[model samples]
Target: MSNVIIIGSGAGGGAAAWRLTSKGLKVQILEAGPSFDPLTDYKQDNSDWETPFPVKEGSQGGYIVAPLQPLTEETQDIRSWSFMNGKYVPGAFRTSFGYHHVRGFGGSSLHFTGEAHRLNPKSMSLQSDYGVGADWPFKYEDLEYYWRIAEKISGVCGPSTEQRSPKNDRVLGTPHPISYASQALAAGARKLGLTVTENSLAVNSTPQDDRADCNYCGGCLRGCQRGDKGSIDVTYLRRAMQTGNLTVTSSTEVLKIITNANRITGVLAAVDGVLKVIEADLVILSAGSIFSPQILLNSESVHSPEGLCNDSDQVGKNLMETLLATSTALHPDKLGSHRGLPVDWISWDFNDPISIPNVIGGCRFSPSMAESDVVGPIAYATRIVDGWGKDHKRNMQEAFGRILSISGIGESLPNSKTFVDLASETNSHGLPLPRINSYIDEMATDRLRFMMTTCRNILAAAGCAAPIEEFSSIDAFSSTHIFGTCRMGNVTEECVVNSYGQSFRWPNLYIADASVFPSSGGGESPGLTVQALAIRSADHILRNKGVQ
Candidate 1:
């Protein structure tokens, strides 16, 4: 039996595995998807210039082909393209909200935009400070060291600590070069009295951690071909593998957690085609917010008839997602919109400030098309530009580098109405599909409207001609940052896991993912927090359990 069995090889699982292996623990990771090596698997030669305006494949508006079978007959839906995509399972749900996640060795890290930002201290203590959302059991100071450790391991690049908010001050690397479009946006935001700063990214600006420096290819979303992006496969997982104490089993799906009385004994999984039982002294579920709850809820036994480690019945409640709004502006002169990293600039001045009325959480502003190619540009132009034929082609050509977009990523509070539960139907794997129901409350809607207005004003201030408002409200399917399904708290009545990510019902079982987040921190990306918390969880396990 392995010392620890980690389910999922994403940011959380990878980080925990790395830390545990470094501490001389034997770790086994089971991944539901195939292994991905960026060096060989990344499509470097495929450029959007070759095929402009390709047919939309998914509900999230992405064109890149994923390496998985198409949706099963039972899951097909034209309106809900998420079900048709290989990346996600099509479970029946009532709300427009869906998840954008990848099932692979590196998990969603493979397609992350690389924007890495820390949550404000105030955001961490939301309930204590603002009377909304659950307060994190631990303070930000407790995780600051782990955050720095995560930054070093991921090779994150960002502005100096002094330049950023005092709430987040531990810097590990230098920031990437700002694009012309970002500079213009920053200048425009400054005119509107909003502070714009360089965004911290997982992509390398200078060669470090044995990874090559970013060459400014502007294809971060498709996958970083040059090894500059810090996906888990290349960073934590690679290091963990090198330690010789870790074994990663890809293309293996975990069906349920096997429990012996009150303790978790192992995991029952489908390896290749046959069912296999892998025993472990400890089990860490990092299958993400949507699937982690699904696995736990499926693990029914005589000792725990409801589910393993779900005595509180809080395993799949409080599903939270980032509320996003986007606006496009046509610059009078070409500003080279599609250059450098996708999200080079970020402004947090408007995010959940105490003075802003009806604002319970913050919002972040970033350049929307830094990583876009010709196809993306053309598709976006079709929405903003007029008529077809020669005029359309001419306008598209002219708008390629002249148009720029700014997006607002806002924080949403976890409400009782939004949650993840078992659907009536079963998936291809013969397991109950996850049913997600998410709704934007009046306060969240008002926050989105305010964020959109701020984006428009910034674009206009940036000297853009006729800044057009494109989209608003939370795109339930578009958010890659999902959290709060299996939250951490001091009491079992409110949370599934404790502050250290250990299950209250089953002590040996831990959760190292966004699912453990008690409150979704501000508008910043949750990648950094996920990794930091995982590292912290690993430390807790080592300190309590010791080397087996």
Candidate 2:
């Protein structure tokens, strides 16, 4: 029997394994996708330039996304925002959803842009501060220590304390210089009296832990070929293996969790291709917000008619996704916006709810060019140019190295309209595919509108004649940071886990992923926090069961 069984090898699971194995606990990880070796698999140095990155979601990388719901079309609608007689107006933009996530040894971090962010201290108290989303059980100060630890291991590069980001003040490593496009955006933001701060990225700016620094290749989303980008595979999982107490099983899809009375006994999974039950003393669900709850819901038995660890029937409730809006403009100069890091600069001037008067939550925008893949001439032809042949070629040439994009990340308040559940159909693995339904409430829409307008203003401030606004309040199914399916709170009936990510319903069964986040903090990337929570959960386990 394994000492501990973690059902994923992503950010949360990797960190949990690192801490537990370092402390002398035998750990096993079952992942649904194959792992990759950066040296051979990345191939960024030799890849053909014609190939577009971020291959269709779930189509490649063994990551399957749930079918889009409620609203299915990808076309821009009026409900979000549109030009009415050359004036921007809100139209009937229905929210079509597409989850962009990679399921592999390192999970979504394999393709993530590596922006390691922490929640704004005030954002941790959404219920107390803004009355929109629920408040976290603990304060930012409680998690700061863990954030620092995650950053150190991940080799995060950022501004110093004196030049700290609004979200985290204790950043360690130094950040790279802003891209030319970002420099323009910064100048524009400063003109508007907004402070554009350096981004805290989980990329090595200097050699650390034997990994090379970033070469500014601008292929972050395609998976970093160089060991510089701090994906969990190279950071936490590598450390866990160094302890020699961790075993990672790839291409093992979970079927259901087996429980004996009030505690988890093991997990039934398809190991490679064979179905088997792996026994364990403890089980940690790190399969992300979607699959984690789906596993619980599929674990229904005579004892748990609904599901294990789901007495509150909140297994798949309160599914919150990333709320986003962005704009792009054509610059006069070939700023070479694609060479450096994707989003080197961000602004938090309007990151406070109080700063926006009636706005209940906050939002942030960044100068995103390379990270968005708005760089290559091919990208210009496909994304910016509308025609074909000669005209298109000329337009592409005109737009190359001249595109500037500003994107906003905002908090999506948990609403009854948005959630996930079991669908009637099954996936290729025969498990019932999770059904996700998402909505954008008026309050959330207000935030999206603010972000849209703000991005456009920044572009204009940067001396661009026209900044095309793209409002995704009801479109652009960017589930970049999913959360709150199995929420954590104080009340047992109202929560799925405790402050330390221990499940309330089942003993020795814990969740250390985005599934346990009570609320989606304001525009913060969830990776670092996921690691911190998992580490904390492992420590809680150590406190109860003894490490050795």
Candidate 3:
């Protein structure tokens, strides 16, 4: 039997494979999508590229990938996403809406903005802070060392002051100077009694670990052609391959987990529609939030008829996504903003309720590098810009240097209703398709509105002529940051994975993906948190022989 078989070669699996193989263990990684050569597959000019239809287009049969944003339902290669209200609705047959990510070697992190911030201590104690959501089995301190490890491995360079733990005391490289726009926004926010800090991002600011610094090109959403971004393919996966103990099988879809007497034994996969099975002593499911749970739900055996390691019925519950929206403001004078950092200034006060009662959210205001093709022209033409060619150019010329673009990211509390399960409809291979039943509670929506209003006020305070807020509909949920389809908890009955990320029902099975996040780490970007937890879980598995 193989020593380890890791599903998905994303952040979690890539980190695990790096750590495990470095410890002199054999590891095989299975990815459901084709291998993407960054230079070959990515096109910087999106205008020439084939993009998926807009969500308002009401069609489901196309797929597209943006380097920064997570994949939406409109980007699906096939109309296969199932939305769950009562019965599952197929993607092509009906307009089943969802914010599900796609299959890839690096997973959703491939398209994520390189902002990497650790979770606040309060996030680890959700039950204690809000009287809602379960607390994490482990504390931030438990993963502090691993956080640093992941940081060094990924070559993340940011302000050392942003790190909450002492173990993260050492600064890896020179901090990127805060942009002029960020400095000005911070000044304005301070007037409102809100403190804005330089954001902790994962992009390399200086040369470290053989990786180059960011060119400040600001095309992060289209994939980094510069090689400065610290994605898994550049970091862990690269190191894992160096060890020669890790084998990566791209374009291989995992169909089921082969188990015997409640113990994981092997994995069944389909590579280009050819069946392949490999026996393993240990299995780590790091297929991501939605896909991870879908895998568990699809894997059925004599011992687990419902799904593998799903005796608790909590495999696909407590779904949560961070609330997000953009706000636009017209500045009095040209700030020359969009030339610097991606997300430079952020409000820590808005992430929690210490500042605002009964409301948990976070707000960040910055100059938006508006997309010229998709959102910007559409937004300008639909509302503000009245005329077509020359008049539109004149209006865009006026707006281009004067626009102050802002964005707000909020958290959604754990609610079982916002979950993903298998739809009744099956895929082309006769497997049940994934279904999303996600909906934000009133608290989350209210918090979103509050953040948007706060953004408008902040812009106004910053000397904007006028600021407008854009509201999102309930149907649009997938701006990346989806969590809790396979949560961790104190008890076997309430959660799918234990504190150590081991399956309660299956002894040799484990999960290292974002799906195991207990309460979604509500505030800040969760890239560091995911890496820290994966490193710690990997260390635990290696030491304790796979149990907590």
lDDT of 2 by residue, 38-147 (tens): 65556467645434333422323222344343433333332333221232322333434457777787888988888888777777787787567788999877888888
For model 1, residues 1-548, the per-residue Cα lDDT tens digits are 78999999999999999999998999999988776555555655665432421222111211111122222343221112111122222343323433567777778888787877777777887888879889999877888889889989999998766333455466667888888777888888899888777788999888999999998767777777788899888999989999999998877888899988868999999887579999989999999988898888888889888887778888888888767767677788877776778888888776653535767887778888642232255455544566778988887777777777788888788887778887766755677866766666767767777777777788899888765435443332445788988999998898999999999978999999999988776688888899999999999998896554
Mark the regions of model 3 whose C-alpha exceeds 4 Å error after superposition. 45-102, 163-170, 360-384, 473-475, 545-548
Q: Could you say which candidate leads in lDDT?
A: 2
* Residue-wise C-alpha lDDT for candidate 3, range 1-548, written one tens digit per residue: 55899998878898898888888889999887655566656665455332321121111212221112222454232111112122223232223234544456666566566777777666667677767777888887877778788878877776677534335474555666776655666666778887676666677887666777887755555566666878787888889999999988876788888888858889888876788888899999998777788789888778898887688788878877756555555666665555566675566676543344566533334434332111244444454455578988887767654556666676667775677788776655678777766555667666666666676667777777654334242224444677888888778888898887888877688899888888765456676677777777788778876433
TM-score of each: 0.89, 0.92, 0.86
**Best by the TM-score measure:** 2
* Preferred candidate (TM-score higher): 1 or 3: 1
> How high is the lDDT of residue 112 in model 2?
83
* Alpha-carbon RMSD, each predicted model: 6.6, 3.6, 7.1
Cα error, residue 305 of model 2, in Å, equals 1.0
Candidate 1's TM-score: 0.89
- What TM-score does candidate 2 reach? 0.92
2 against 3, candidate with superior TM-score: 2
- lDDT (Cα atoms) of all candidates against the true structure: 0.76, 0.78, 0.67
